[model samples]
Target: MNTSPTNSDSDTLRVLAQAIAKLILRFRFSRSRFLTLLDEELVLQAKNNDPQANNVTLSIRTGINRRYIPQLLSGEAMHSKPERLKMILEDLKWTSQKHYQSGKVPLKGSFNTFETICELRASGTLTYKAILEELMKQGKVKVAGNKVEIISNNSEQDNEHREFARNSVEKVFYTVEEIIQTEKN
Candidate 1:
């Protein structure tokens, strides 16, 4: 009759749940979105064991309802912020190089300036303004009267920070390599 998780198992689950909870809160991710992504990931894992995995099998393995599986996996996967920031910097670097004398791009544009770069590089779920604001807040960019200037690569410390962010993004989004391989095949 005693079917609850054992003390050690419960503690382990609690620690993992707590860490995930903190990550969600720190990143301002919605609870429902997180749940959906968790379900999608579980379903993916289930498929690894049984290639012909179905909703019922996924639900049983993941302990999530079969009904929610479809809806949860319908949305696109999210790319982490550090990855987007790195991309923005890359695009900005190009723009800076193209306009070497100025070293800045116009902040305003419908499809040509920083806006277009953000749209192409960052997640569509994020607004154009939100991405720009985050970059500005991180001191990776500065705003002029009508342009945004990248504030990087002038010193060793800035390069170190960029390297650190690149590494963090690669670690957190390592699954991207798997997704790419699957898509290719």
Candidate 2:
């Protein structure tokens, strides 16, 4: 198989890569995290096409390690791992750990609750109530009576985040495929 990129191909690829890098930087993603996400997308692509796709083939195609491919393709991997929707959830969890001390806290308080945590974590432009509402909307937190509980353990939020990330990756892949098809035309 002869594979050589033309000048046009390289230029297009460079633009696409820079665009993706900009997104990664915007999300503050680490290199390992980006690699893991890339691995997950490749594994998902393989699985959709072939249920019995082996790790060796995936590793060869994706340039990811054979051992890593299995984990990326595992039944739990897609659902258990949080992807792009990590920031708010992570902040909430951090607050729960650092301020709550116990697993629960008052829903609205001067300290150690949604108000205080949000105050500390949220930017000056955003208020604590807004963040609390977002968390509740995302199902990452529950408010009962005067208390708010953060689902700190590996919870439904992670699944939602992973699902969102997978959908996003699928969209990007679809767009890239469309570009390739257009280039061929």
Candidate 3:
């Protein structure tokens, strides 16, 4: 099965959102060597490219305030809302489809209530709950009553925990593969 991100419309939206984010960062830092006119042209291009795209939804996805959408679009604001931006990005590439498809195996712990976990499961990853469990185990996610939440708002730390969990998963998979190979021998 093709698991490419391009297969889903959400993927397009995700990419667009990310690109916009980069633009926001560039605009904020005032480091653009290009002329101000060029920067203005870029923002206008972005605005024109997706005027129909729900700005409010994008705000929700990016964790930016809906009211700020006008400001961001107007070139009055430069900084992206860091928290919401991370959530939306996470929603885009949070999990593999295979894990959700199985529907039997449990996740670690942290992914239980993640907004994207259920969607990932629907897309064929492990069940959302299973992913949540695994996330909790590694401290990447926190949960109460099946609703997974982020324990730390720190993006760097969250990324680190995710890496740790991925590594742990790989090690476990290797062990299982070894056992299977031994049995076959």
Candidate 4:
């Protein structure tokens, strides 16, 4: 019994130590990769039409310094205690592949759970009293609870709403422009 306990203790300690080492190595590599990605994003953004481009843009945009960049990219900074560099390289490769793989954005329709619940009620899925009872049972639509958290549409108006407003403004502006052009003629 004593010998078994000793072996178990040793095994537990070994597992814990391995987990800690792995976590440390992962953090070191993740931070380094994060810096590299930051630099690349900065360079790309600097080339784009954004007006804010300065010397510190390399550091500010990439969130990394030139001095650290070489150390990180070379894999020297991560230091091969074991599979640290390999893991980071694998992660970066996957990310690169994902970036290169182009696909059309999937179309999405309007989804409102609140509206669905109302429609279900109208269709006699349950009576209003039955719905209230279900809500009380679930604790989500709490009645007696000290704090009743209501699910509300807190999200801002969707793109469709913005598009409608934009089109309305454009139509008005174009009409005014046409009138001006006609008067000038």
Q: Which lDDT values do the candidates have, in the order given?
A: 0.71, 0.68, 0.50, 0.43
Q: Model 3: how far is 164 from its true place, Å?
A: 12
Candidate 1 local Cα displacement, residue 123, angstroms: 5.9
Which of the two candidates, 2 or 4, achieves a greater TM-score against the reference? 2
How well is each residue in 56-136 modelled by candidate 2, as lDDT tens digits?
Answer: 877767777787776777734533344423554565566666766755667676766667655665558677677677667
lDDT value, residue 161 of candidate 1: 59
Model 3 misplaced regions, further than 4 Å: 1-89, 92-117, 120-122, 153-185
Q: Worst lDDT window (10 residues) for model 1?
A: 74-83
Candidate 4's TM-score reads 0.19
User: Candidate 3 residues 119-170, lDDT tens each?
Assistant: 5434464555565555566555555453344454588876886676566546
TM-score winner between 3 and 4, please give it.
3
Which residue pairs in model 4 clash with each other? 38-62, 39-62
lDDT against true structure, model 3 = 0.50
lDDT of 2: 0.68
lDDT of 4 by residue, 1-185 (tens): 23445775677567655644554343333445544454555555653644555445544545666555444443454332333323322332343345433211111112322223333334455443454454345332433232222322233644554566556546655765686588579
Q: Give the TM-score of each candidate.
A: 0.45, 0.43, 0.23, 0.19
